[model samples]
Target: MVPQEAYRPDAGAMTTAIHVRGLTKRYGDVQAVGGLDLEIQKGEVFAILGPNGAGKSTTVEILEGYRKRDSGEVRVLGIDPQKPTREWRAKLGIVLQTANDAAELTVRETIRHFAAYYPMARDPEEVIAKVGLTEKADVRIRKLSGGQRRRVDVALGVIGNPELLFLDEPTTGFDPEARRQFWDLIKGLAAEGTTIVLTTHYLDEAEALAKRVAVIARGRIVAAGDPATLGGRATAKAKVTWADGLVETDTPTRTVLELSRRYDGEVPGLAITRPTLEDIYLTLIEAPE
Candidate 1:
């Protein structure tokens, strides 16, 4: 797995969707956060990738104003998260790693209840439809399967018409098909300008949805950038191979032309390959902390 890295937008006085500096959190002798810094732009889909107990949750919770940080400066929507107001809280939505156990209330009922907490809530039924729970809107939450229940959680999270959404391992237990469907829903939300912050162990999920990604390890950002270019992958040489020879080069087009001339036509079995997200992720995570 690729070890963790984080986003480094720029350093200066400018407002961003999320801004953090020197963030730290500790529990007794254990430090959960160690002088971390981050920056996320508005309308951006950002992912925070890490393994279990890598301080991903702690960082996110502090951003949501649910956990107190020992020290740092945090601004979400240009307002300090540590001093959150009711309006500020309403603008943020969260889908936790684990949803609360469902009760007898139907999906529609649960969503409506949560919606009422915000001043400007999206239509409950509309949100339900968006999450692909329209057919099960009236089904009791207790009767839904795990994937269905997760859809309901998503429905409730977006029902508040939040400006920013936090998804912490949102698709944890989903099957492949369900995961794809959920990805579409998230894409739709981002298309409409909802800033999303996701934390997931699934490298594929992060690469697919996030515009930028940060990998965390040992309570600090180990890597951060465009997933395609992070850790020098964008500039990383591709292996140009054929039946007869293998070479690594950045200028594959030029190499291919030469090979074609020498081969008297197309280079047989010509292929250019670069490191995949999974390969980079494993190397990063397995590195010394």
Candidate 2:
């Protein structure tokens, strides 16, 4: 695991890594992206959350210069993605939702092969260790498990030592342990000043990695803020439940105190709950756009 110090950024420094204004995209009559505006800071891990066909992929593709937008101003790493240069492309690392790799190549060979493309690539052996693939380094790609293969995809993504990384559903097939390991790698990278943008269906993953989150729906961002407080979650009413009853109120602390007193210091089966990230995400996506 990466040391905790790596996650700390320079004190009070906020730089813009990605900027978008009046972004729009359409296919036939369907609007894929509609006037979406977003700004992500340097060295930040930002997550985009939304259901299928919600335009999350469309927006990301445009930002990556893989797709064209109908209208908008977009600047990634201080350059317009539409006019990508070799230097501009070199600074980016992208891990798509799915990729086709050379099935016959060993993990070590694959990493080495891709590393040659970057002028300042990381050491292949070190990259292998970072992604927890040292044991499978010599194994052919075709022989690895689904989750293990996913790790290779990540290894390739960070091999170039990119300044900005784009991860689309990065942990798709990872097991519980593997997922945790991947999170460590991401936190370590963020600590080292690599700006990361992530899109995932896992709310827990977003809460664990992203300092800020944006929820997209119907081709527009319906909500965006700190994951802990999105959609007024921070101040939403808490539910205090005990042995025989439950009460929803603004001050759960007061309710608990009264219950403790009434129960002579110990309330049976007492539980206090507030809106969780998943709860807020579901609510936001379901609301009318």
Candidate 3:
């Protein structure tokens, strides 16, 4: 849900779905988030990544109205999250890192019960099918596998028909297949105009789904941009590999062209690669705080 007392947007400002400026949070001497600023457009799948204790969760909690910020301005759907109201809460859905236990209830019963909380909830049967849990609808919660249980968690999150959805490390325990299915489900939701904010350690997952990514370290944002071009990544040097050895440089195309002349043909095992999101992320996090 969102806060009702935050600034109200004019018609033109409504284009941006989420906006945060100089956001900060502290616990005594420790700073959890230091003057963080971010903006997300509507219907965009944005990913936030960070090392442990980097204030990622804290920032998200503030956005979700689960926790209060010490300072800074934040807005979601034109409302301040800190002053969350019923109408604002109704427009947001959240899937936490861990779902609560309802061990004795069947999957269908659980979803049905939660659906009653929303004024415009999705159809229970449709949500179950969308999450690939139609077959487990009648199965008891305790008997379901970990991945299947996660699907149930997603079902509950979307049952509210929220305009914005927050997912924190959603596929932590899923296998490859289940993870793919979940990614597809997220894409489907975004396609339907749902704004999504996600946090995860899986760089590959971020690359696959996020239109843009933000990397945080030591309670501050280190880098933010498109996944492929974060931190000048697209313009960074490429690593060139050949049968003899490998070399890294900014002019990969020139290197390949010269190598082709030297070899009089295609160079054996010739490959060119740029730094991956994970590589850049690790480098950013390990830098001096």
Ranking by TM-score: 3, 2, 1
RMSD of each: 6.8, 6.9, 3.9
Candidate 3 residue spans exceeding 4 A from truth: 1-9
Supply the TM-score for candidate 1.
Answer: 0.87
lDDT (CA) per prediction = 0.88, 0.92, 0.92
Model 3: colliding residue pairs: 1-89, 3-80, 3-83
Model 3 gets an lDDT of: 0.92
**Highest TM-score among the candidates is held by which one?**
3
lDDT of 2 by residue, 1-289 (tens): 9787765532212377898999999999999899999989888899999999999999999999999889988988888889999888888999888876789999999999999999899999999999999999999999999888888888899999999999999998788998998899999999999999999999999999999999999999999999999999999999999999999999999999999889999999999999899999999999985
Which regions of candidate 2 fall more than 4 Å away from where they truly are? 1-14
lDDT of 3 by residue, 155-264 (tens): 88899999999999999989998899999999999999999999999999999999999999988899999999998888888999999989899888899999999999
lDDT of 2: 0.92
